[model samples]
Target chain A: MDTATTVLDLVGVFLNALLGGTVARRDRLDLFGFLVIGIASGLGGGLIRDVLLQHGPPAALTDPAYIPTALAGTGVAFLLDISPPDWSRAFKFLDAAALSVWASVGAQKTMGVGLGRLPAILLGTITAVGGGAIRDLLLQRVPAVLQDTRWYASVAVLVAAVEVLGIATGFPVAGTVAAITLGVLLRIVAEWRG
Target chain B: MDTATTVLDLVGVFLNALLGGTVARRDRLDLFGFLVIGIASGLGGGLIRDVLLQHGPPAALTDPAYIPTALAGTGVAFLLDISPPDWSRAFKFLDAAALSVWASVGAQKTMGVGLGRLPAILLGTITAVGGGAIRDLLLQRVPAVLQDTRWYASVAVLVAAVEVLGIATGFPVAGTVAAITLGVLLRIVAEWRG
Candidate 1:
């Protein structure tokens, strides 16, 4: 379970970093700016979650793979042109998957720390959306989650709520799976319909 | 000493909240916006620092006085018209004092937790400038500390460094006093010259 969690965490970081890198590229930012935005996008949510959890240094800082994965995502974005429509389709799916994983994991971690259900839900939502929010803030723009027509932040909130409910019903594993599945489906459907 | 620190912390929160409320007023934000900016400006830095410290929940959360103090500041700003030059002058001095207190206190708290000097300095600087940075982000503007022509972040860094040096020299009390004094003087002078 720990290993699976770690893998999912890294996957979320990488995809989010790529998304952030795309924004940096659009803004025509320099290498330094790419690194800053990419890292923040990849790790900012987890960092905020861990900090609020009163856990040790954020996993992004303490874990060896996180930073390198973020950098690798940035490198991929910097080196390759991913502006094609096909790439966008792929990115949307990947981003949805990442958000699902982060939201569930954030809720699980918060629950593990013995916090109440409300904080768990709040932190879970934050962990899913915080990176993109930070990235947007760095660009001096309103975060998409705050104004997105698609079910972005809403998907995260629902996923967190599902996870919290699952835990309450003593079906942690099933809850995670269900939450992720629901989140991915909702997000993709929202995007497609929009 | 504890009582003094608490007093200083509350004072900083009130002043920073007022500062944030002033900005919200200028932006013609609603009451909700004023409260959001005010609480964020007052407590955001300390919250960030505490989270990084891996301490228990942030003092701002655990302490009863903080949120009310912040709200009070916001209320004052909402009620009064303090757009005159005289009020601005008084605000400048109070703001300077608050900055100094927060910077030194942040460094001191970091050191008290048995962390190294570098973290101490980093956290200290964050604690001083983080609130305004967050307020700006919420407003979708670039943070002043990041781009201010005035030596705002620089002053925080210097104050933190001074605190770190004082601790290293086994003069913690003297360090806090000197750091605050230097910070206040430098900030006032910078504002005056500007």
Candidate 2:
């Protein structure tokens, strides 16, 4: 279970880093700026969640793999020639996937810590949308989750709600997976329709 | 000691919320936006600090008074006719005071948790600057702490350093108070010179 969670977490980090790097490139930020944005976007949500949950120095700060993974994602993003707008479809898919995984992970972690349903749900949403919000903020843009009418943060909220329900009713693992799948599909569908 | 700390904490929250509310108003955010920004700016630093230290739910969430204090600050900001730029001098003074208090409090909390020197200093700075950074991000501006050459974050760093040094050498309370005083003075001087 730990290994699976780790793998999913890395995938989410990589995708977020890519998004952050693309934003940096668009803004023509310095190399340091790119690194900062990439790392923050990749790990910012988890950091916020861990802090709110009273978890230790965030996993990103403690784990050896997280920073390198984020850096690799940023490097790939830097090397890529495709503009973010041109890769909107791919970005949307990756974003939704990452969001689903993060929301599930966050909800599970919060519940594991004995937090109540409301906190678990709130933390789940924060974990899903935090990195992107940080990325936009660094770039001096309003967070998409705040402004976009499409089901961005809403999808995470839904996933979190399902996770809490599943936990309360038993069958946590099954519920998490179902919620993730449902969230990704909803986000993609919303984006496509919009 | 607890009473003193609580007073300082409330003052810090009120000032930061005022700053957040002003930013929200300038950006033409609705009432909800005003509340969100106000609460985030007032509590963001402490939230980041407690998380890093593995502390329980942040005081802002646990203590009933904290939220209301922040709300009052926002309400006062909303009612005021003075624009942020127009009140720059007062804002600078209040910002400096808040920064000093938060940095000192963060360092003290880190030390109390038995964290080492480096983490104490780092968390201290985060506690001081995190709120303002969040405010800037929400307002779609580069964090002033990151971009401004001013002694803003630097002063916090210095205060944190002093705090750690004081703890390592003994005399924690005196060190914290001295650091706060020094940090506030340095910030005011820098603003005046700038």
Candidate 3:
């Protein structure tokens, strides 16, 4: 939980919430809709993280940072009166960004929780995708990860690879940095071309 | 868990899905919407169960029974297509039924997880409320639990109390029977009176 990581997680949650609320707002949702998408995306990662770790609720109810972070994000969306076409492109960027950070953070978090390297790698990937998956499912939309053909699974796979490689080679910092960069860059490139 | 408790839990989920989807269709939400509500109410309890257990994705994912059961219920709803009414009344009953069942099942399951009576009670209440809370939040409606004062919390409280007392007194069968009957009767009475 480095300051950088903590900030990243918070930012990740906040940004994800902002984008999720804004985009989902295009639908027929109302005030509570905004809150739902916000919290689902913001706390979704850690909630999945906790579930994978067998810790349950994943600090959602207990963690004040998450709820307020989501709340603030949703507020931004409501003020903006978002629609689908407005941020489709921006959403892609946000998705890319969330994927990158989540990959790295999720992996390291797995390690911190005392999971073996393999489980940690898997957990990291789950943490990254699980939130969005749940959100989409709740919205009654098919999950992007399951539908996309652009190797969406690779982002998670590569992150896990980096985690395993980092641990095995004792270049944890370097491995993580490379892994994060790969994720961010890949996601960005996908979004750019997409 | 005792055989009867388990049976009731499963049946409650199946029944709620039927009831919920029927209500959804009456609202003109289409197949997808009905499915959403059906699955949401059905998995609502287990989602909370998994979250509390830190098992993540709920047992619904692991157990093949959950979705199929819900889908079957959804089909029934489609076929039955309960007559339309004011959205408000249907919603109230949906919330009430789900809450009652969840309160009972959540408490029983929490105790089964080996948690203390207090956590079990709290978890049960949360479990009962959690799914609908999430569902309504996503739908942009104020959650009934947060908005109403009638017996939302009371039902959960009563269910948890029955489960705990049954466990403590070594009279679990009687306890569970009382819990279910009490929840249903109370909900019916509350709805009728109000």
Candidate 4:
């Protein structure tokens, strides 16, 4: 992957892990639970994307950097005293950032693998939301993707579509940045309006 | 794989789906929820195993028979008038059966793929309990695998270890049958005693 893409993905992982850790804390989970949820949230979406593409063992399992990055996010959550209600707005913004970057990267990777547009977009959306869905599941809550009327998953889909279109038209870098910006903005707007 | 293994896996899928459907019904979810939970419960374990193993697209998505079988299980749950109290005992029994079969089959598959014994046993347990965990998560309940004091996951781990040992010692068929029986008995006994 290009350095830009890699940077974006790492940022996404950290943000997602933060989101997971916060949720775990909210549920009164212990340290192990925080770590588990953090790692799963950070890497879960990418793992699902790779698996669907029949790529080798997920990068999360093979790469050494992933676990530590996730753990760092978890550590932040454990050390911070921010309550869920207090941080809810900031958390939404962070979640949207992670969602946008993951969607862009996931769709780009899928397209690079020569998958059809439909699967690429679908998988991209899956990649963006899969981690949080898993976090919610582990916390014994209905997944926000499935329950919320807000355009959470839709924003990811839109980002993926933009990424795919950019690749198809030979403007991949511009397309990715544009998609991420659009997705994050849409999510923030939706949350704000709601 | 072999016909015997295939049949056992199918049975596992059906029973897991039934368990998932019951949970969905209990949660008063709509039709989409029932199907989503049913499919996840039936195929979740296998999907997790396959992804970890880097096996191709999970059999649930590739094999036509899987979705139909899962759907059938959901249909039964939706149509049946069985009360939760009435089905509780029966559900436990069926869950044990599925656990036994899935554990055995998963361990065998992992070994066939040349994974080491430790991973084989762990993946086997994951295969047995993953679906139920997913079902519980979707239903907004803590997964029994993580919380229950019962020997639910422990039984599957034992079965997997036995299967791996059987393969190593050249008694595959007998070992599989014996492990399945032992697992089922352990689970049933645990439930009964509780």
Q: Best TM-score goes to which candidate?
A: 2
Q: For every model shown, what is its TM-score relative to the native structure?
A: 0.62, 0.63, 0.59, 0.61
TM-score of chain A of 2: 0.93
Q: Comparing 3 and 4 by TM-score, which wins?
A: 4
lDDT of 3 by residue, A1-194 (tens): 67776666777787778877765666646665565567677777677777667654455545456667777887898788765456676666666666767777777777776778777778777777777776776666778788766656678778767866886789988887888778878877765676
Q: For model 1, how does the per-residue alpha-carbon lDDT over B1-194 read when each residue is reduced to its tens digit?
A: 37887897788999888878888888777665676678789989998898778779677755668778888888888788555244676677777778877888889899899999999999999999999898888888878987868888889999999999999999988988899889889988998898
- lDDT (tens digit, per residue) of candidate 4 on B1-194: 68877776887888777767777777676665666688789888988888777766666656667767887887788777444567676677767777888998889889988988999999999999998887776667778988668888889999999999999899998889899889988988898897
User: Each candidate's DockQ score against the native complex?
Assistant: 0.19, 0.25, 0.14, 0.20
* Cα distance off (Å), candidate 4, residue B183: 2.8
Model 1 misplaced stretches (Cα beyond 4 Å)? A88-90, B1-43, B52-54, B59-133, B142-194
- Taking all chains together, the TM-score of candidate 4 against the true structure is 0.61
Off by over 4 Å in 3: A82-95, A149-153, B1-43, B46-50, B53-194
Better of 3 and 4 by lDDT: 4
Best by lDDT: 1
Displacement of the residue B181 alpha carbon in candidate 4, Å: 2.7
TM-score of chain B of 1: 0.95
What tens digits encode model 4's per-residue C-alpha lDDT throughout A5-74? 6776777888778778888887888899999899889888898788777866677778777878888888
lDDT of 2 by residue, B1-194 (tens): 38877787788999889888888887777665676688789988888787667668876655667767888898988788556667777677777877888888888888888888888889999998998887777777778997758888999999989888888888887887888889889998897887
Index of the highest-DockQ prediction: 2
lDDT of each: 0.84, 0.82, 0.70, 0.81
